[model samples]
Each structure stands twice: as C-alpha cells, then as structure tokens.
Target: MDFDRKQLTNEQLLDLYKKLLKPRLIEEKMLILIRQGKVSKWFSGIGQEAISVGVTAVLHKDEYILPMHRNLAVFTGRDIPLYRLFSQWQGKANGFTKGRDRSFHFGTQEFKIIGMISHLGPQLGVADGIALAHKLRNEGKVTAVFTGEGATSEGDFHEALNIAAVWELPVMFIIENNGYGLSTPTNEQYRCENIADKGIGYGIESHIIDGNNILEVYTKLDALATSMRENPRPVLLEFKTFRMRGHEEASGTKYVPQELMDMWAVKDPVTNYREYLKTEKVLTDEYDEALRAELKKEIDEHYQQASAEPAIEANLSEELNDVYKTYVFEEVNSKSNSENVRMIDAISQGLKQSMERHDKLVIMGQDIAEYGGAFKITDGFVAQFGKDRVRNTPICESAIVSAGMGLSINGYKSVIEMQFADFVSTGFNPIVNYLAKVHYRWQENADVVVRMPCGAGVQAGPFHSQTNEAWFTKTPGLKVVYPAFPYDAKGLLATAINDPNPVMFFEHKALYRSMYQDVPTDYYTLPFGKASLIKEGDDVTIISFGAGVHWALETLAKKPEINADLLDLRTLQPLDMEAIFTSVKKTGKAIILQEDTLFGGIASDIAAMIMENCFEHLDAPVKRVGSLESAIPFTKALEDQYLPKARFETALAELIAY
Candidate 1:
C-alpha cells in the first residue's frame, strides 16, 4: 500500500522531520564525546533513525515500548528530557537507573518504557506480559518491542511469538534486520527469506517494509497499531535496514565491504528525509539549517547540565536499600476455627484466599487450569476463578516467568509454577538477570512468585527430583521461602505472594501429601525472616528447612535421650540468623541439615555463620549434614541412601555425645 502524503498536515510533516533529525544529531554528539573520553561506549543508530522515530511517533503515550540499545530515537520521540538521558549515560544520580546500569540498559516507568537487558530476547516475553495486562484490563493498548535480527535466534523470541499468537495478545514484534549480528552476516543467522516469515509459522500477520523510507514506516505502523487496538492480536514487522557503524564504538567496521557501505551511505534515513521535505516545500534550506543548529545547541547544553550533576556516592546502607518494597503485615485476631489438612491442600487454601483478597492476582503454569497442575495443587482453581485468572501455559518456563514480571509491572501479582524444581534451570536467566535485578537497577517492583515443586524422595529421578532452594537464596533482590509444615506452607505462601519483590517459593514434593496439621481456616500470613521454633531444648540446636525439618523431627523422636532446639527456617534469602544465634548460644552446639548435596549447599553457609557469630559458646564444632554429591537415583533404596536422613541422624548423635 502506498503512503498517503495528503493524510498528514504540513506542521505534522515538519515535526516528523525534526523527530528524525534530532537523534541523528544526538548520535554525532555522542560519538564526539566517546572520542573525547567523556563517554565510554555507544551503540550507534546513526543511519536507522527512521525506524525508531516513525514507529514511536505513531504510538500513543500510554502505550509501552521496550527498546534495545541502538534505538535512541525511541527515547527522544517519547519526549524524555535530553538532560535526564544524558545524566543516565554519564552515571549521575538523576539518571533513570540512578547510575545502577549504564546507557540504554535501564527502564523508566514514568515514560512507559521498559529498557533492554544485555540478553536481548527476554524483554520480548516482558512485552507479552504488558500486553497480557492490557488484554486483561481491556485497555485497548498495544505493546511494541524492538529487536535485531540476530536475537530472533534466541528461544525467547520463538516462545514470545508463539505465546502472543496463541493468546491473540496486543503486541507488535518489531525486528530491525540490520544486516549483521555483531560481525556475523545475515546469511549465517538464518536460512529464511526474511525475519517476518518466521512469524507466519506462528500464525501471525507479518509484513516487510523499506526501513530507510520514513513515510512508508510511519504509515504502515500507524495502520497496524490502529487495527490492533480494535482487534487485539500480535503482528510482526521486519524492517530491512543496514548498520552504518560497528556494533559499538570500539568495534571497527573493517569487515563490511566498501561497496555495501557506499550503497547504504546514500540511503541514510535522516539525510534522505531532509532532502524529501525540502523538495516538497515543507521545509526550506534556511529552516533546516536553523533546526540542525538548534538541535546541536540543545544536545551540548544537556550534556553540560548532566555532567555537572552529582555522582553516586558509595554508601552501604543506602546502596542496600530498595531491594524490596516494605511489606507491613496487618494484625488479625487468630480465629479459633481450624481444620486438619495436608501440605498441598494448605497451599491451595492460601492461594484461594489470596485470590479472593486481591482481584489482580493471577495464576499460570502448564496444565494448571483444568488439569490442576502436575500435582493437583490448583485442583479447583479454574472452576472457582475462571480460566482467565487461572491460566494454563505452554511448556515455556522462560516466557511465562517473564510474563509474570510484566504483569507485576502493571500492578498485578502473579504466581507462576514450574512443573518440577529441576526445570527452573531453563528459566534461570530471566529470574537471576531481569526479575532479580529490575528493582535494584530501575526501582520497578517485580511482584512475582515462582512456585517450584522441588526435592528428592518419590523416586522421580534426577530430572524430576532436585532441591533448588540454594540456587536463589544467594541472589539479591529475591526472596526464598521453604516451608516444612502444612501451617507454615499456607502462611508463608500467602506472605510470598503478597510481597512486592520477586519470590522463589519452594514446595518439597515429598512433603506435599505426607505432612498434615490443623491449619487456620481464616486468612493469615507468616512474616519472612522469622523461624518457627518447633521444639526447644539445651542438648544441641538442629537447624533445617523444608523436608530436612521432617528428617530432623524423625531423628529426635527416635532418640528420646537427646534434647535439642529444633528451628525450621521459613525463608532462606531473609535467613533467620538471630534465631540460629540464640539457639546456638543456649545449646553451645549446632547441626545444619539440607536435602541438597553436601558440596555447596545452604547448610554450609548457615554453619559458617553460626561458627562466626557463636564460636565462643560452642562445646563441639557446628555440624553440617546434606545429601550425597550425586544425581538422585530412581530406586527407593538408593534414593533413601542419597538423602540426608541417615547423615542427620549420625550428626545429631555425634554432636550430642561430643
């Protein structure tokens, strides 16, 4: 379809010219600064300004855009103050990320922009989440995400596209085929005719356009965005473009053939748009020169102002703050009414109660809706809450986790379940890189709870049985919760769901059905960082969590002579060191138990802390007991031997005798 030039007024045409020109001028200024050592690095979008400018210009302000490093025009087109962006690049406190991240690696909620991480494709999943929010609220808003052709090879790209297509989400998957992925050419990347063709495989409407032509890009994108708002669905647009410079300033373009450079040089988006406007009498040569001069002056002034701002100071307390939003527990009277229930039922009750309390709570995972998940934890959720809130997802761990993050971005709380604990390794990048770092990087709350059904006991073998709590406990900006009893499972799950930071809630598969207790019927929450004192004595302190707590209980019951102070640590990230110290001080001996291997488990960390804090009070050395360092075997006998039950019993007796 041809672009109707008559559709735009003369003033709007002039404004588009300015939008295309400003980023080009800014890139030139940034290059100068890089040469002068004022700026460290830059991803040049020098020749590809039209794609960013035209696409952003066509979108509404309330709509969200996730832009990569090269799309500087997206920021400029969104009317973000030049000084603030400059401040961010200069590592000033006033920048969007407050100097936590560099360059375009940060996002600003104020501008409805979600910035890219070093891993390019995760943001596509995040875009799906934002689109999911839009679809849920019936907001008629579309989410636009930008990526280079090289990133399309990532699994997240396929996952995000398939999810959007399956759900018919309002998302625009925009790809800039810039001829190279760092030094590798397009032919080496994929065999498909174009990136948009891959979208067709996913049943999405795909289009290809001349990226150098500003009019074509603007008109095509505007029509697509309008249609999407009326009928919510995903579309892919591939803009065939060229990289005018190296990937970054340090990487020289010695690999590009001179002929290709010469060919693309004349087709520059900014320069050709300027010539077209002047020839059409929309902009005079005199006005064009004045506009260029004005843009240069503004860039220089903003750089100066940003450079003059204060740099970040090194303060430990201040730096440690804002990892999580402060959650104040409401004081509720303890109801006398209670009923005996299994751990699985208690967790289900907690989720049902939380869903009743918060209208924005959403639950998603594989076979979770009608099938009620692999373990039947969400058995009746679909019937009670409907399929919209309790969603069934494809076997895409990475995308679903990121979508949950996106939902949290729009004030919705999400509970995403991993079918098995061992499967979390597939989605580790987004969890560790994006969800765990977003708040610290840009102060955006990732209100997501990932339910991990973990631990080894049911002969499910290595693939199904694994204790992965230690994986997330070491990561900052994340909460790790592991419950032992039915009561603690329900209360802590509720607390984890309510917290404003990302949480990894580990449910031991072995304890899900075996453990039972009288759980409170009414809504309640257990605070994190507080350990439940199950039994108190002076012989020794048995510190453990999850299934390890059960083993410790069995050991104590079998040996009636040995008295011990048993503590179940409810949360690992916010560890209850105070309780451990108090118990160790009274007992003067301690033993840490865990289901993970003994080589590098959380038990070692707890033992180290106990020794460091309560060394003088100890009679015997702090004992550490964990599973054998090998993959869990499927046989019942081998599985029992692989676990830490026998080790915990031996360690407890040895510590008491010592």
Candidate 2:
C-alpha cells in the first residue's frame, strides 16, 4: 500500500507487493460491504489486479487514462485513495464527482484521469480526442484507453484506430480481453485469432501479452508507453486475462460454461501471480501476510472515512443546467418567399454561405470529402473550402460525433453527418453523455451540428431507412431541426452550425432530390426554434416537419375542398411551441405527421404538447401519422407497406372527410 505513495526505493520490493495486493483487498472489502448492505455498487477488479497495476506501473500520473468500468483498480494503483473510489462506488458526495456521477464515472484533474464512460466504444474516441488535443497543443503526454474485447465490434473502435493511426496520436488502445464481454465470448464477436490482430488494419504496433504476469505486463506496457510518448503513434495491446467475478454485481454468470470456468479459473492472475512470487523467492509468507494486513487497514480506514462523508446534496438539480452558456443564439423564425430551389442545392448553398460568413465553421462525415457526402450535401464544399474544413471520416459514428464535440470544445463550428440517420444510434452515447452534458458539466458550450439523412420512405430498409429523430428528441440541451425544403434546409443548417449547442439537423433523403425552392445567394443565417406556416387554413392544423411537410402540401393540393393550416416545425426540440399552439388554436383540429415510427415517435410528443398547452383550444381530437410500430422490412413491397407515404393518402382522406 505504501508503494502507491510515489517515491520508490531498491529495498522496497515488499511495498510494491502491497501495491498490487491493495486493489483486490479493496474489492474484497467492498464485496463484504455489499453483502452487509453498506455498499450499493462496485466493480471488482478481482482476478485482473496484475493487469491494472502492471500496466499503470509504467504509466506516468500526468498522462491521460481513458479507463473502462473495472479499471478503477488502476486509479487505486495511483495516489487516488480507496475511500474516494468507494465513495464513487456508493454514489456519495465524498467522491471526486461529489455524487453527480454513477459508478466508475468519477475522476478528477488531480488524477489526470478522464472520467470513465459506461457506454462501450465511446472511450476510444474520447481518448483519441484528448490525445488529439495533446497533439494540437504540442504536448508530449500520452493517452491510454482501457476497453474490452466485445467493444472491438463497435464501429467507434475501428474508426478511432484508423484516425489515431493516421494522425500518429500518442495513444495506447488496451483491450482487457478477459474471456468475455458480459458473458458473450470473444470468439463469437470477432474472427481474428488474437485481439491485437485488429491493430494491423490500422497500421499500428500490436502486442499480445500474458496479462496475468506482472513482470510481463509491466515490461510490455512500459516499452510501448515509452515508444508511444516519443513516436506519438497509436498502439494496440491485447491483455489475455480472465474475469474472476461476474461483470457486475447482481449479474448472473449462467452463460459461462463450467468447462470454460475450470479452464480460466486456474489461470486467475491474482492467484497465479501470488504463487509465482512465493515460489520465486521474491516474496515470503510473512511478507504476504503483512501486506494483506496493511492493505486491510487501509481499506478499513478508507471505508470509515467514506461512510462518514456528507450525503449527496440536491442543489444541483438536473434541470438547473447550462447546456449552452453565454452564447448569442436566437431561435430561428422561418421566412416564406415565392421562391423555389432544389433541396440538395439548398443544403450546399446554405453551407457554402455559412462558410463564407463564419471562418471557423467546419464539416465532417463519411464519404463527405471525396464524394461530397453520400447525398451531395457537401458537393463543391471541399473544393471551395478545402479538405481540412470539410473532412471525411472512416465510418465511425461515435468517434465522428465525439471528434466533432472535441472540435467544438476548442471553438470550431463542427457539423458531422451520420450518413443515414438510422446510423445515428451508433453515436448515441456521445450525443447523450458528452455532447449533451459538456456545457452543463464543463460550463463551456460545444457548438456542434450533427446532420443526418433521415426518414424511411426511400425503401432503403432497416439499416439505411429510418426516421429516428425522436431518439434524441427527449434529450434536453439538444436542438433538433428538420429542414423540409431547399430554403428551409439551407437557412436552418446555417443556423444550427452557428448555434453554440449540439443540434441534430435531419435532412430527409426523399426531400434531398425531390423538392425545389429558390434560396437567396446572400449570406444570411436563420434563427433557431422557429416554424413556418407553409399554407394557412382555419379548419385544421397539419403539424409536421421534413417529409411530413411535403406530404401535407401534396395532400392539400390534391384536395382543395379540404382546408388545413400547415405549420412546419423547423426546429423540433425547443420546439416552436408558439407557432404550434397558435396554429392549433386557430384551427381547433390537429393531425401530427412524421416519417418515424409511431412508437416513441415525435408525433406522440407533439400530441402530448398540444394536449398539455392547447387542449382546451381544440375542437376535435388530435391524430398522428407515422410508420407502423414494427421493424422496417427489407422487401421493397414490405418497406413501402411499412412507410408513411403508403398510408398518408388514406389518413388524409379520413381526416379531410371528417
């Protein structure tokens, strides 16, 4: 335990022994505490203490550590007291997060540790981004990211490796391949014989080590850590170990076979290493017993201190958040003109105009650089503004988004596309955790615009076709906009990019090429949170955005006998409630339409909003139109059958006839 105090001596090998033993002892103490109902949450780094201490033995305290959930042992290996770690586990105010974070999500500037993100694969990008910052600042420190074998399957892992390798970042991507990612065996996840082999695709040095051996783990990580700090390139390390306990408390290990457990339990790093030390004459029975006693005392003192700290406070309510701070952002009001322009051209021109006005505006996405984006939204953008501004990514949605947030952190208007909006789920964690809370937590605004090709009418099936705008709709501190026409698309995109908060700007794939409306060439930006009254009527309010607007217009054009007020909600979150309430109040009847699924769709949210604020003003019940509540089928016929366009005419007929 004393070896964790920083200063080491040649005769202090016994103290070093205590350092390795402390984490497991701490975990054992926490486990008993759990049984006694004193501790609520804890990730036991039980069997793999060697991997944590051994690897961190070579790492400097000043360097960055993008630790995983169980890597709290590494934090304990350093100067972070067991009390604070346990306080974090107990979700108490004594922890560095002061009770704001859940288990393993707490760290501090003193630790030089980036807080652990619970979601898999996101740390790869956050590690890469912090490394990117170190590189940009011309610092020599390195970033070591801890992840699991199962996380390698995530797109962000591949993308982070590709970006890190290409940039030659000072990072070590370490995979604690502990046989299973929450009971899903590694064999089922990847075909590569060794986890380190995945690094070859990224052109980085890869090492597979006997992770249970302290000497080997330390030596391998030490050499790599040296090369990483000097060469400033990425490295992948596969730590072959086993999880002695279930992935989490209250987690069942029924999925683990007895044969596999028998095979791995013998190779348990802590037991084998302890025996190895005893057999090698490096440690004595007295030394082992004494180390255990000292570690126990430290654990006891820490727990007592943790239990005595003040309880969690409620002053920092979740709603009292500053998601965007001191930013001159005005809500956009839509302006209608008798002008027509192509949706694709509107997007391009809008970005083009924004780039002209704002010097720091930048765009990034897959296929955006060479192909000018999959739908030509970035066409002529790279050529005009250069590749640095309109950069292309390697199909890593999570990393792509986190990188955009990183860009925004240092003052750049980052606009990233998720290709098809359906793929946005891949980056959901970063959007929800980092992008959404960065302003609130760090008290700094990360002005980033996330653009996606959304909706399901194109018959692209489950993977490519989806109207999932609502996935992030309920996520406060984020502004989501659906640009319907060329003019609206252009103006809103400009507005989103310039705004100092994360914005999801969804462009319908069907509208990209279908509708044409003239957009002015003048460099102008629109405000956020505004709606456009496309067509005014006194009978009913057709509430929609994106493809819904097009459907409403077409429906009205086909039936001149039916009068409806069409209000386009240019911005979804921080919705144009004024316009929606006004139009619905005027018409006294409402029909909400969106191309997303009816289950968890934005229509339901709009309906709830109307019912909450404008219910008494309504004459008839509010109705919603969206995709059926089922997985989008691959067959073109089935896909069409599942899409809103197939049912739009019928719904409109019924609504109008009523």
- Mind giving the per-residue lDDT tens digits that candidate 1 earns over 473-551? 8898889999999998888888888888899999999899999999999888888899989998899999999999888
Query: Residue 285 error for model 2, in Å?
Result: 11
lDDT of 2 by residue, 324-363 (tens): 5545765544354445667888887778877877777767
Give the Å error, residue 550, model 1. 1.1
TM-score of each: 0.99, 0.78
Q: Which ten residues in a row have the lowest lDDT in candidate 1?
A: 325-334
Number of residue pairs clashing in candidate 2, backbone atoms closer than 3 angstroms, sequence gap of 3 or more or interchain: 10
Candidates in order have lDDT scores of 0.90, 0.76
What is the lDDT for 262 in model 2?
88
Residue 314 of model 1 has an lDDT of 75
| Ten contiguous residues minimizing lDDT sum, candidate 2 | 1-10
